[model samples]
Target: MTKPRVLLADDHRMVAEGLKSLLAEEFELAGIVEDGLALVKAARELNPDAIVADISMPNLTGIDALVQLKRDNPQVRVVFLTMHRNPAYARRALQIGALGFVLKHSAPAELVLAVRAALEGRTFIAPDLAAEVFRTPAKKEAGPAEALTSRQREILQLLAQGHSAKQIGAALNLSARTVEDHKYRLMETLGIENNAELIHFAIKHGLAP
Candidate 1:
């Protein structure tokens, strides 16, 4: 019988190594990836049966990565491995079509079981997160800092911290006009009437310093 194949994605090298050690015995490790995009690329190329991902990875978050990878291959299952014990994120992950979420603090044995369950077409949320999601609601869908794409969130955060448009442009390798356009669009999306409101909103949302 062929073992299940999986791709590992996480930013922490030691964590990845530890997981690889635990999984290699029961699974055929396909390839290891360090970022969400690489995980997506590997998933499309390797077409592995499963993916175990860390949620806070760079370039793309694990949830965003799952969204993209499932777009590419709906049949492949994903299990999020995170240190977060937040019921909200766990439920959101399920709502977003993830098959399972394994808490990093979960026993190593549970990780193995989570993988097996996912491979067998079963959903496996962590035992501790078995509560109704109390996810924050009523936040504006488009915040003042949301004009930037996933890649631009960090940049916008800096801008909110009082960086000049030229400084932001230089730092991001974008033209000043481009940064201004982003600012304009961000304000429009958030329905802010002026730069003062924009800055206020950004600061309130912790996007600004």
Candidate 2:
């Protein structure tokens, strides 16, 4: 029988390698990428059966990448593996269509199982978080970060990561002036007065890795 094909995405070399090893016996490793942007690209090119990804990755976050990927291919199956133990994060991830949310600390024992579950069209939340994630109200008011457009969120993350307007423009294919305009507009939308506060908001809201 053929093993299910899986793509791995994590910025940490050691962690990615360990996951690769962990999943190798039961799944075919379609590809591995170190950033969310690459994860999006690889998933498009490779069309793996499932993706194991980190939520906090460079260039684009796993959630943001998923939003974009889903627009193009809604059937894509993603299982997030991350250090974030927050129930809110898991709730948002599942709400956004992730099939699994496994924490990094529990990955050795749960990741393969999560992948298997996702491949079988089942949802899997880390046992430690499942109750809390499900108990949380699904219709809570949107947070400041949640109100931002996906592009704005991307720009916010890049800004918090210390990328200048020019660099961000280069990465996002916008003009530097446009990037600056976006910064100001997003700051205003979030009621932030300066770059420092913007960064603080981004970090506080899990928009920045």
Candidate 3:
């Protein structure tokens, strides 16, 4: 049988290039994209058998792109390439019609396995991440980040976009002080401080590209 055709999407140039070469050894690398909107457009244009995209991408986000792709091309398979080990994200990816959610920390072999499995109508999650996820300490039940409300997550995303506290407040319809409060809380909860750290965190977890 012929190998599968795969489209790889990630904002990190080095990562996208590296994965493309690695996966190319085993499959037909249909294409690669650097942004979420480009990913959507590439998928529509290329019509690859499967698409593997990072969760956080510029413009539309990986999840949002996946949603649109599924709507427009229901027969296409989607596999999320994420750094987030959070079970919540895994569940959300599934809810959005992704065929699989594979954490980036998994062995390169695992990624290959996930790609082929997804092609064959099977779902795969990184084994180690899956284990740790289920073992989330009950005592640590509410992860500090989890304590923040949905509004806070929204603010954090904007902050990573280089928005000033006042700008974030204006966009979210809150006072600058409120934005500051949320920023302080997010730093405390996510164990990150300053805008730089927040951006690093978001990109690390595939929440930003």
Candidate 4:
């Protein structure tokens, strides 16, 4: 049997390394990309059978990248590997067509199962979070950060991670003024007064780890 081709997207080098080692025996690594923007480019270029990505990534979030990838290649399966245990995140990933959602702290064995399940057209969630992830919330309330557009959410996460507007602009290929304008708009939309408040809001809403 032919091994599936896999692409990996994660900003943390260590995490990527660990995943590469874990999957080495089971899959063919098409390529590795460090950020979501690069992930998009790599997906387009490599045409992998599956992708494992982090949710919080520089330039673009993994979810946003997956949206683009799906647009271009709807058949490719994707499994999200994230540190966040938040059910809301899992809900969003599934809504956006992710095949699996695996928590970073879960046993490495779970990842293999997730990959196999995804390839078989089955959905997989970390065992510990399966109940919460599948349960319907009492109310479909959008979190403050969730209300923002994908770009805004990406910028917000970067800001919360202590990147300045200029740095964020460079990373996202936007102007510094544009990045600042986004910050201003996010503040107004979220009823935040400053960067500190914005960071607080991001953490509260799972936009930042």
Q: Please list the C-alpha lDDT of all candidates, in the order they appear.
A: 0.77, 0.90, 0.78, 0.88
lDDT of 1 by residue, 1-209 (tens): 89989889998989999999999889999889997668888898998989999887754568767877767777879999998786766876887788889899898988898899999989887777755443455565654443546445544455656778888787567888988888777767677778677767755654432
What digit string (tens of lDDT, one per residue) describes model 4 on residues 117-178? 99898999999999998887898666665678878988888899899889999888899999
RMSD of each: 5.5, 1.5, 6.7, 2.4
Model 2 lDDT per residue over 1-209, tens place: 99999999999989889989999899999988998778888999999999999999988899999998898788889999999998888988988899999998884878888999999999999998899999947576777777899899889999999999999999888999999999999978988898899989988988888
Off by over 4 Å in 4: none
If ranked by TM-score, best first, what sequence of candidates would result? 2, 4, 1, 3
The TM-score measured for candidate 1 stands at 0.72
How does each model score on TM-score?
A: 0.72, 0.94, 0.65, 0.84
Off by over 4 Å in 3: 131-209
List residue ranges in candidate 2 displaced over 4 A. Answer: 138-140
Q: Clashing residue pairs in candidate 2, if any?
A: none
Q: Distance (Å) between predicted and true CA of 148, model 4?
A: 0.8
2 or 4: which has the higher lDDT?
2
